[model samples]
Target chain A: MSRTTVVAALAAGVLLVAGCSSDEPAPAPSSSGGAATADAGQDHDYTVEGFASSVLGDGTLDDLEDVGSASGEIEGGQVEAQIVSVVADAAGTELVVVLRGDDTGSPSRWSESRGVFTDVRGVEVVDEAAGWRLQPYTILDVSGESDLGCACSEFPYRLGEDGTVVQALLPPLTEGTTSVTVALPGLEPVPGVAVTWR
Target chain B: MQTRPRRTPRWPVALLAAAALTLPTAPAHAAAAPEPGSTVDVAGVDVPVHGTFSLRAAGNASRDLVRGAVHGVRRVEGGTAVYLSLGLPASASRSLPLSSIFTRSRDYESSALAAVTLVDRPGMTAYVPLRGGDAAPYSSDVSEFRALKPGELVVLWAVFPELPAGTRTVDVLVGDARAAVTGVPVEDGALEPVADDLVPQAGEGWPKIAEGDALAGAEAPWSVRPLVQHRGSVDEVTDVAETAEEVDATLAADVLFDKSSATLTAASQDAIARLAADIAARGTGEVRVVGHTDSDGSDSSNQTLSEQRAAAVVAALQPASGTAVTFVAEGRGESEPVAPNTSPENMQLNRRVTVSYQVQEATR
Candidate 1:
């Protein structure tokens, strides 16, 4: 198993610190489930910040929770990802994740197959208490047609220097467990991510 | 060592528990915890097979795991309930088959130390989880154990067919030798809440979200844990499954075909030919070859890829089987999935190829 170094820096700004969890970094995870990290030796430099995102930001914009912004960089120019808000979804456990790829003096491009929409399935969430590590699923229609993509940002475009795509992780975690860890293929494991129940 | 205020056993549950008492060779013993700290060393991993038992018990005295912390085997409405809140030690062996008692046999994985026995009646009434519904029954929850961290705790349960009412004390046999719990109490009462983790979570009611093509489509309960039925045999060597009616062989698409490509893996013809030679002896009629893909790409793309992969397998297997079986190729696309497309293990299972031939009547 290739080791990916995680820059355990807590970034400030739009991201709010979650008071619910321990600051201790999660123990190293087993690489048994990391098929997407096929690029084993790909040198990874990323940051993981776990916090609470309290805002719904729509009609319930005024009714906000602790929805925070954090990012983990797998590659220098690839993208930055974070589990913005993890909520108790009707289906199970859901997480609103963001992947930003807008960096100056680096690659700034969105292809048809690449970027956040396609990479949504690469996000992994784990509830250690429940012994669950949920994989990404493509939500489908009743007729077994793959029309709309998963509950993620579709056809996303960058505004100025900001390139962000939000994807929802459908929950299938056990009912009793909540706090979890989030990680992309090459991303270091981020622990103490809270799950807000709806 | 604390006891939960015992609720008197229910009527039907009591009847079954009492009845089970007759099956065991030894007369029912008083509820007693298995020898605490009982452990078996398997492949250098100290697996916690033995633990405390009964809903009356609170925690296990084992060093490696805290098993059945909440509930033991209890009679529910339809069947007997087996619930466990496991707490693992820092060096606990991380394998599901080593920990949880599955309700049935699984599709793929099997360990030498697999198969936990409800060793109550010795010869007659000892039951393992039922042989599974379909597809060579396999535990769909392998990822949980593999992903287990050091000293982490996870919960698992299975509802087996009810035991006799008199079965107050029973032994939970884990692996080949070790009895996980001895003389565990079997009480009757309300069944605990079922853990919903077995079923992969989906967006409720197929609700369409967002207006874009990349939006989160609704989760339609179409695909299920694919089943294989009736008389069957599994070849762990070549990854083939056979039943009384048909001889079906499964090969992972990952091994047969590379990423997005329909071509077979380089220099892999010898393996397929070896597989063909084995199945040809009993296989008859047309060999139906089907391919499947994971839910990564778009539907149409994955469909095309699946079809191409199927055709590729057919091409490779055609000459190997000789004129005994005609190879027919088709791709069900991403439709039929053995597991949910949510995790690496499940997705790997979803991407696969199957070659089927009717079993010779004489052989059956």
Candidate 2:
């Protein structure tokens, strides 16, 4: 029960899978598993390595703890993240994770520089029991470009003073599941986040 | 996966939690947000407050009807086409934030007000439109939706990946609100292909559901083709998604270049050669090589690096992919990403070189 594994592959030009783990194994990474594999012919360039993994976090949903609203902060150097709320809609699990800075100075000192906070895809929804991670839901324009500015906090993001609130909308967590986890990028996973309904 | 019966009988909040109901822990459901409209339930999904989405109810299933609409959806080869006809009741003068209402894709909250959703109850999965169904400003490039007067209906449709096999009924939600609609059966047969004109607009008057065909020519042709990645085996550097005609291959930037440099790494050459050979066998003629980067550096620098990397890929693949194939290189900075730049694993996907080409032989 201690060393449960959830392996997510980083397929070069092919996948956007997260290296997320929980108490169970991960579901299939992509939608269809019928595409030509590395051994199907073009075996030269297929690589599942050179990952950009979390420097501070290991991206694991440790022990299935149902400690509703564990106030323990997911510390990320200058900035800290806390699960504000978990609102359940029909298919959308809208989570508000407030991020703030402990040591205020220039924004450069913060762990989540500009790169991570700017794009809304930073947050992902992990269904621990199902052992699959859902990508952030994004509203797309005609040309297939996503407009996720409303979903999360915008950057140059004042991670100081009041700190910014990052609202990530993801697919609904599995039914009957009581609690889940939330990890803000470089920060560790905040376990036992309650799934509240309206 | 066991299909639990629909949660139609929702007892009091505290009791329901103690009992066998599958609803979320809504300790705040009865407490915080309470609106005007009475409680309406669809396949166990509680439309929190039915007041906001004041539309008419159809039959026992309570299909949310705005005057009338195409009953079910057109199940196409690529996906399903949902043509909805929405209208406000005569007395209720409501301003529909068109974008907010239908913008609810599989995993997005378009706005705070309401987001549309389609639930495959049996499959226990929710699906948003793969494309289309967005309101005027975004979907049509027309005008932003003005406040819709009563008796006026908006005919909007979107394309979604084909429903899970054996799935018949789907629940439609506009911000947790599904007036009477949910449990709509999947229409029989394939979606009729017409001149794509499923324009999202508030029409002059209400549309009668005289026949349940594809909204009397309210179908959308795929501008964005159905793209699927085959991932049975583990492949690190090259990831590919293919349409019947085009194959889009994404190669890892880490393996291909040094930090901020476009110069192809010596090790990546072998990989490129393999990819080139694959393309040469399948490609008909033209190949577009586009470069992308993760959001780590400044936007300007990322753009420059992406462009340079694309050119390098083109140089590497042009000769190898056959003389008949022409390679063109383009750069999309940190704009379009397959994954969020949150973790290193996600960021690695953003930094890649994508080479797309037409497939001469149809390969699924």
Candidate 3:
């Protein structure tokens, strides 16, 4: 076969597979799409369109996967937090949470003292049943793909496609604690997000 | 609507050319001149270096003028210590304030001297000479603001931990004064002199032999407090605050734009150029330019102004060639402040722009 014929056939095969992948979620559309198609008289909630799928969950410290999610809001923008990963080391167990801000342009703010992450008032994991309130411990050590190109902060975090992913290192969950909660100061508390390892 | 012509398959030919291009190009060596002002000639002594601070001419009377020269660099335990001989020329007829040279408190972020970055790493810990040992100063103390008399040369040391091995040279910046110095061979953790001809003249009150004696010990007498540590390998060049995830940088808005205007000043453009180079060197990434303002203006006005300013910075920061990096502009107005806006100094701190980068790790 001619080279062009082979190239065309391969391209067609790839497109066929992409079109047939119904199980996979489609990529989010660009925010600029609405602006290009809008009429002068029409009003649009850019916030909702831009950031409605806001979700946050826990995952391993070294990976980005949805373990659980929590309700979060900043200003008028709704936030979703997913636990990206949980990493266990000599120090403690680190719960990596990915915080997404839909509609809020560049959700996280930068501080010289505090690295880049959202400027929410407070973030903590609560075990109300055990009467234990765990503060988020910032990860001082960063390397390889986990390093944020700026100065190192206590928390290991990276800016995502729609928001920020932060890691909180806390003491290992003790026995007898049935559930743990994740809290953002202004948003509604998300309870029972912790998973049972046993 | 226009119909596009079908393209021919050119990948076979391109792939062959790419394979040929990937052949070993050249060994890594220090570029003879990587900076515009790479050479400094003071008192007829020529030293090959790079910096923004000019040793060629006297600085303006209003600003404290500082000049630096790298004497030697040696590997110490846990870090690399760079011995710098700084001078405030007496001929300038003005005393250079010490506050501009080094901070007295541990809070390096607020120090004017914080601008001096160790180019090899993200951030550097600065030390000043004291009796029997070195003291790491912070920005919080007022007593640190001693003046530098003319013709007086003070030797200071900056230590950076875990510098990538095989790093033969590194750049040091003190305010605008920048120097790229070659590392000297170390014997017993002490720097051994290279060729005698390579040594630059140590000006009056600064004996060349005495300079090496100041840093003779294997360890500094006082415990060295590292402001920024390199947890990664030396090959990685990132911001002092940067980790594997992101890079954050703050540009004072007052230094960049005119009051209420989105236009960039010449100095701000230069600063942005440097920032762009740093971002580009990271290989590939996305840069989000965020604009912030103090609580002086109305909410709506502040928001609009902040957005416009951010857009202006983004425009300047974009690479001239391929789109390996994406730029996003955002404005927070008066919503976020690093400091309280009540005081003038604090308000000055509030008016700023932040550049954050989400870098993609290079597949090695």
Instruction: Tell me, by lDDT, which candidate is best.
Output: 2
Residue B45's lDDT within candidate 1 is 19
Model 2 iRMSD vs. native: 24.3
Cα displacement (Å) at residue A23, model 2: 25
lDDT of each: 0.41, 0.44, 0.42
lDDT of 2 by residue, B9-110 (tens): 222322322221222221111011112222212112222121112222211012222332333354654466554545543333354444423433443223
> Which stretches of candidate 3 lie above 4 Å from their native place?
A1-198, B1-52, B55-64, B107-116, B121-147, B152-154, B166-169, B175-243, B247-364
Residue-by-residue lDDT tens digits, candidate 2, A53-155: 0000111222112222322233334554556667654544656554445433434233342344344355555667644454444333333333322223233
lDDT of 1 by residue, B1-364 (tens): 1223222212322222233333332221111111233221111112122243211011111112222332355555434444443333333444333333332234223421123434342111343443232322222233344332333334444434456665664445332212144444565643322224442111001111111122122111221111122111122213443333555667777767778999998645655786677557767888888989999989999899999998988888777676777778999889999877988988988888888788675663
- iRMSD of all candidate structures: 26.6, 24.3, 24.3
Error of 1 at A6 (Å): 60
Going through the candidates in order, their DockQ values are 0.02, 0.03, 0.01
